[model samples]
Target chain A: MAFRVVHYINQFFANVGGEEMAHIAPELREGKVGPGMAFETAWKGEAVIVNTIVCGDSYFAEHEKDAKEQVVAWVKEINPDMFIAGPAFNAGRYGYACANIALEVKTQLGIPVLTGMYEENPGADLKDKILITPTANSAAGMRKAAPTMAKLALKLMKGEVLGASCEEGYMPNGIRVNFFEKERGAKRAVKMLINKINGKAFTTEFPMPNFDRVEPGKAIPDMSKVVLGLATSGGIVSKGNPDHIEASSASHYGEYDIEGWDALTAEGWETAHGGYDPVYANENPNRVMPIDVLRQMEKEGKIGKLHRYFYSTVGNGTAVASSRKFAEEYAQKMLKAGVQACIMTST
Target chain B: MVKEIERVGIPVVHMCTITPISLTVGANRIIPTIAIPYPLGNPALTPEDEYALRYKLVDAAIKAFSVDIDKQTVFEF
Candidate 1:
């Protein structure tokens, strides 16, 4: 007997209408519909889409509680071996609907669930909780997305153990699953080293965390009228280290008032950073925070005014997520204070 | 931290010893500094000279804010 599967899609893929029909509520249709056909082809008669649940993107977003209850009830009644919802691509609302519905089915009914979406979709925030195969930013990627989802779905239905996210083509979900490699660790390391030394392309087993590149903000039109803010990951603070920012892996940042200060005298300020020798920064805190030069610039009209407060934190061994959160908090303060530009120093 | 500040639409220049690390972390504006321990100052120099060097670097960083750039840029001083 063919393994039974339940598929989910939005109104756009269901041919119910475009944005005009996106308000339509959840409905069940027997067998594959729209992109389900692509999955059907990939399944190769090994499994059949026993049912498909279609929901409007807007309806799902507006009535999430009601929609989830309906979808879970329908899935329970059908009781398919596996559940799949959307290769939603870049559609934000649809991706949300698919990821959420898939999560609900897995948790509420204990069914294996799978979905796909573009990495930037807000729904991808749930990637760590669900199996999300990355797709291109548009529905044109359906051809590739469907097959990848189907292959993973089939394995999931067969109750087979899964491999690492990289090997299985799913987003890294923070769970480290170990598997045997064809080559031993020592041999693999040697081969990689040789490839690197020879300048040959070789994929690293552990890649650096991918950073999102932000477009440069438009340049300040005139420096003469700008309120220049100063910030640092160099850990310069008051001589006493009032907020007690950690020397390494900082948990918090300090905001100091230098409103009337001209230079950071050795007696007045010091570095909280443990990553480097603190002698120079301690002798002259200006080395790491540059308040002395910025004050001079303010007086010399090189800049309009120096922001009164400076934010400081130690960057040594700090997690990128923590760093981002600290900056997000202080960046809002800078913005609210009418800071036009900023210079950040790191040690 | 520099990237996050710039992401909020505020122009920010990162002054650090390792420009490559700054580039990798997606900082849009970068200024190479003397060393990790004293990014804006040089203890070997006379106080006046070290002060001058720090001033020059800060000036360069300020200038970076007014120059439009489409990609990550290292502002050399």
Candidate 2:
């Protein structure tokens, strides 16, 4: 039996009025509507689209909750084996509606779902959560999108394993599936490094996450009046590392009282970091934490008194997620204590 | 971690040996250091010399903290 499929598209693609018909409520028709013709040709009788859900972009966006429930209830009756939403291209509102409905059908109904959108579409927000094939920024890419989406949709319905995003022409969905590579990791890394040195392009095995860029806080008007707190990811701690923080990949942070301290002496402290040789830091702990000079600044009135407690953690090999957790906890305590500014040191 | 602290609206200056890594990790105000193992003081030098270098670096860090910056600004020592 041919797998039954349900297609979703905006009113514009349904031959309804363009912007003029944008306020129309969702309506469904039996089989092969608009772009469904292209999908039918691509499927080659392996699967047939049994229904197409047509809705206006404007109506869907403004009344999403009701529209979603209404559309979902209707699709539930048809109960397609797979669902396909628009190759919405760069149409923001259309892309958004298609992505949302597609996601809903897959999640709530457990139906195999497929969608396509331009990389910059607002609907791209759902990329990591769905199988979103990449389309061109405009509908001009429709020819390429329909065939690709159809092929993938058929495999999806048959429960066939799919290849990586690059090979299948889809956006990365943040789910990493293991695949064999031609070269060993070390050799690949060496090759990448050599390419980098030669100013040639090489794909990295692990791409760094794009962290949020935080704007710097307003500068202190009078440094002499504000209390200063010290924080370090260099793993400086009291003698014997009372907290036993791991020298590398530290799981926790330590807060210690620096009250009445003139400097971090050899007897009182040592570095708990393992990323580097600990010889010099153990000999004189101030090199990493700079407690000695900070004290001098307090005495010399170069700045206000230092806060009594300082926070420390090991940054080496520490996961960014854990680091965020530790900072969130301590930063609250530091703020409540009226610490106006912070100085962080990392090895 | 420094990013978390600054997100709370408290001004922060990060002093580190690896300036590029610090920037990549999203630090706003940065101060360059001499080495990783000895961020503030170099053991190869005399104690007095080490203290002087440490003082210079810390002073720069303090200045960086006090100065307003619209973006990532590295305070050189």
Q: After superposition, how far is residue B54 of candidate 1 from its true place, in Å?
A: 4.5
Candidate 1 lDDT (Cα, whole model)?
0.92
For candidate 2, the lDDT comes to: 0.90
Model 2 per-residue lDDT tens digits across residues B1-77? 99899988788999998999999989999999989888888988999999999999988888887787898988864
The DockQ value obtained for model 2 is 0.75
Best by lDDT: 1
* Tens digit per residue, CA lDDT, model 1, A1-347: 88999999999899988999999899999989999999889989999998989999999999999999999999999989999999999999999999999999999999899999999999999998889999999999988888888899999999999999978879999999988898898999999999999999988988898898889989886898899888999999999899999999999999999988989999989999999999999999999988888888888888999888999999999999999999999999999999989999988
Model 2: CA > 4 A from native: A62-66, A180-206, A211-226, A235-257, A261-287, A308-341, B1-12, B26-29, B34-38, B41-53, B63-77
Indicate the worst ten consecutive residues by lDDT in candidate 2 chain A. Answer: A169-178
Q: What fraction of the reference interface contacts is present in each model, in order? A: 0.93, 0.86
lDDT of 2 at A27: 93
Per-candidate alpha-carbon RMSD to the true structure:
5.1, 5.0
